[model samples]
Target: NLQLLTELDFAMAKGKLSLDMKAAAPALNSEGRIVLHQARHPLIKKEDVVPIDFELGINYHSLVITGPNTGGKTVTLKTCGLLTLMAMAGLHIPARSPSEVAFFDLVLADIGDEQSIEQSLSTFSSHMKEIIAITELAGPGSLVLLDELGAGTDPSEGAALAIAILNFLNQTGAYTVATTHYSELKGYAMNTEGVENASCEFDIESLQPTYKLLIGVPGVSHAFSIAQKLGLSQDIIADARQLISEESARFEQLITAIESSQKEIDDKKSEADKLQRELQEMRRTLEQEKEKIAKEKQELLAGAEAQAAEIVNKTRRQMEEIIESLEEKRAEQRLGHRLESELRGQISEVEKELSAHRHKRSTDQQPGEIEIGERYEAIDLNIEGVAKSLPDAKGQLVLEAGQISFSVAADRLRPVGKKPKAAGRRPRAGQAAGRTAASLTTERKMHATTELMLRGMRADEAIAAIDHFLDDAVLNGISPVRLIHGKGTGVLRQVTQDYLMRDSRVDSFRMGVEGEGGDGVTVAKLKL
Candidate 1:
C-alpha cells in the first residue's frame, strides 16, 4: 500500500510539473530514434528559457551541437537526456506535440564540471575515463551525452581523441550528442554520414544568444568579433586573423556566412507570416460584412412587399363601404337600380386608382410614449433593458442595462410583459450570482497569508515557525512575505536571514526599509 501511494504521489507531481512547463507525453518508439519539437528545460525560468527543435536516429544516430559559450549547448544536452529519462520512467516531458523518445536500455552522461580532486585527475582525464567506461557498457539501443568531449587537453590531441570516441560510439549503434568548440570536430560531423551538425543560433546585430537550435549547420566561434567589440585594436584583430592558417580561416568565414544567411531567411519568413495573418483577418472581416449587408437588404425588400399587399386590401375595403352607402341612398330617393349600378361602377374605378397609388412604407413609430422603469426588449439588438427616460425629439428611447445607458430608436423597442415594480429592487451582483455565506467563508480561508509575526520566540522556535510559514506561502504561491521579528538585539532577524540563505526555496530576501518596520522586519520572495 505504501509503495502504491508513493507511485501515485510521483505520478501526480509529474503531472503538475508537466502542466506548469507546458509539456506533453512523448510517443515511445521501438526504433532507436528520438525527436523533440519546441522542447524547453523545466528548470530554467519561463522568460529566460528558449525552445529548440531537434531530432536524432533518423538519418543520423549521433548529433554534434557546436556553439559559443553560454549559447545553450550544455543546457540543450541536459534537456534532451533528462526528458528521455523522464519519458522512460513513465513521466511526461516538456516538449510540444509530435515529440517522441526511444526506450534506451541504458543512458550515460558526463556533463558539467567533472574535475576530481580526490582522484587527482584533470578535467580531460576525468572525461576520458568516463567515456571509456561508457564505450564498454553502452551498446545498441543506448543513449549518451558528452560535454566538451575533448576539452582541457592539447587541442590537436583532444580533437583526435574526440573523433575516435565518437566513431566508436557510432559503431556500437547508440545515439550520441556532444558539444565542442573544436573546428576539427565540426568538419568531422559534416563529412561523417549519420552524424549531423547542429548549432545554437546567435544574433550578430544584438550580440546576444538567441538560444535557437539549427540542425545541419556548423557554428562559428565569434572570438574575434567579441574581441573587436570589447575595444580590441583593429590592427591587433587583423594581425590575429592573418596568423591563422588559410584553411581554418576559410572554414570559419564559411560558417559565419551560413549563420548570416540563415538569420536573413528566418527574418523574411517571419515577416511573410505576419502579413499573411493580417490579410486573412481582413478577408474574414469583409466576408462577414458582405453577409450582414445581404441579409439586411433581403429583409427590407420582404417588409416592403408585405406593406404593399396590406395597402391593396385596405383599398378594397373602402370601396365596398362606398358602394353600400350609395345603394341605401338610391333606395331612399326611389331612383332606378341602373343608377345604383352606375354608381357601383364609378366606385370600382376609384378603387382601382387607390390600389394603383404608390404605397410609402414608413419605418417610423407613431408617437410612442415611453415610461420610466418600464422593461423593454429590442428585437434588432437581442437585449432586454429598462426604460430610463421618455423618447427624445429623434424618437429615441433611453434604456438602462445595469450601469450602462444608451439611446436606441423608439421603433426598435417594445414593452416586454408588465412593468416591474420599482419597490422590488434588483439583488446585489454577488447575491444574484448565487453566492452564499459558506462560499464567502471559503474564499476568506483560501486567501493567501501575506504576513507572519514571530515576536519573543526563541531562535529555534522562530525558525520552525517561519519555516512552516514559508512552506504555506510557497503552496499558496505568494511572494514578498513579511516576517516581523521585533528589534531589540536583532537575534531573531539574524537567525531568520541565515535560515533564508541556506533555504533553496527562497529566491531572495532583504531587510525592510524605514517605512516598512526597518531592520526589524524581513521580506523574502519564495520560489514555488
Candidate 2:
C-alpha cells in the first residue's frame, strides 16, 4: 500500500513539474549517444538559464569545449550530466522533446578545485588525484564530466597534459565532455577523428555570455577584447597581445570570421522556415473552398430536376384529357381516323421530347466508340438493339430496336455484347450468315399472327414468343391481340401476364371472359 501511494504521489509531482518547467521525458536508447536539445539545468531559474544543445558518442566520442572564462562552459557540462542521470532515474528532464539519453553504468565527474591544505596537496595535485581515480573506473559504459580539465598549472604543460588525458579516455571508449581555454586543445580536436570542438558563445559588446553552445567550431578566449572593453589601457593591452605568437593571433581572427558567417546562414534558414509554413496554410484554405463549391453545385442541380419533373407530369395529364375527350366524340360518330392519327402523332412528339430531357440529365456515363453490328442498350429509351453504323463525325450512330431506327448520340448507348467487330471492318463469313438470318426473321415478323399459341410450350419459350409477338403487333399497329396459353396448372398464364406487365409497349392486359376463350387466353392491348 505504501509503495502504491508513493507511485501516485510521484506521478502527480511529475505532471506538475512538466507544466511549470516545460520539462519533457527523454527517449532512452542503447545507441551510445546523448542528445540534449535546448536543455537547461534543473537547479537554475527558468527565466535566467540559457538552454544549450549538446551531443556526444555518435560523430565524436569526446568533445572539448573552449571559450572565455565564466561563459557557461561548466554549466553546459553540468546540464548534460544532470539530465542524463535524471533520465536514468525515470524522471522528466528540463529539455524539449526528441532529447535522448544513453544509459550508462557509471556517472563520474572531476569538477571544481578540491585543494586540501591538511593533506599538503596543491590545486593541480588535487585535480590530478581525482582524474587518476576517474581514469581507473571509467569505461565504455560510463559518462565522464571534467570541468576546467588540466587547470591550476602552467599553460603549456597543462594543455599538453589535457590532450594526453583526453586521448587516453577516448581510447577507453568512454563518452567525455571537458572544458578548456587552451588553443592547442582546440587544434587537437580539429585535426583528430572522433573528437569534436564545441564552444559557449560570449558577447563582447554586452560583456556577458550568451551561453548558447555551438558544435563543430572552436571558441576564442576574447581576453584582449574583454580587457579593452573593461577600461584597460590601450598600451597595456597592445603589449599583452604582442606577447602572444603571431600564428595564434591569426587563428583567432579566422575563428571570428567563421562565427560571423555561421550567424548569417542561421538567419536566412529561419526566414525560409517561416515562408514554408505560410504556403502550407494557404493550400489547406484552397482545398476547403473547392469542397464547398462542389456541394453548392449539387444542391442547385437537384432543385432544377424536381422542377423539370413537375412540368413533364402536368403536360402528360393535359394530353390524356384531350385524348379521352376526342375518343368520346368518336364513339358518338362525330370524328374520323384523321383526328385519331393526329393525336397519336402529338403523343409521339411528346415522348421524344421527354426522352431527350432524360438523356440530357444523365451525365454519369462516359462517351465511348459505337462499334458496328454490336448489340447495345439505349440508356434513355431502356431498349437493347444492334448498332447499324459507326458513329459519324458528330458522334451520332443509327440504332435499330424492334423495327424502329433511331439516330442517337454515342453517350446514350452502353455496349451489351461480349465481343464487337471494329468500325469500318468487313463482316466475316459467319457474321454475314447471321445477318442473313436476321433479315429473314424480320420478313417473318411482317406476317405475324394476331393470336399467339402457347400451349404445350416451356415457360421460357412462351415468354420469348410473347416478346417477339408484342414487338410485331406494335410495329403493325395491331391492338387487342389474344395470347392463348390454355390454363391448366396456370403456370403459363401467370408467366404470360407477368411478362406483359413489364413490357412498355403493352398498354394493358387481362384474362378473357365467357365467349372470348374464358381464362384460357390473355388479351393484350399494345400502344399504337
What TM-score goes with each of the models?
A: 0.52, 0.57
**Lowest summed-lDDT stretch of 10 residues in model 2?**
329-338
How badly does each model clash, as a count of residue pairs?
Answer: 0, 0
Scored by TM-score, the top model is: 2
Over the stretch 144-237, how does candidate 1's per-residue lDDT look in tens digits? 9999989999999999999999999999888899999988999999999989998989876667889988888899878899888788999999
lDDT of each: 0.81, 0.83
| Tens digits of lDDT, candidate 2, 288-389 | 888888889888888898899899999999999998986685444323333644554554455455556546656665646667888887765556789999
lDDT of 2 at 339: 61
Candidate 1 positional error at 347, Å: 70
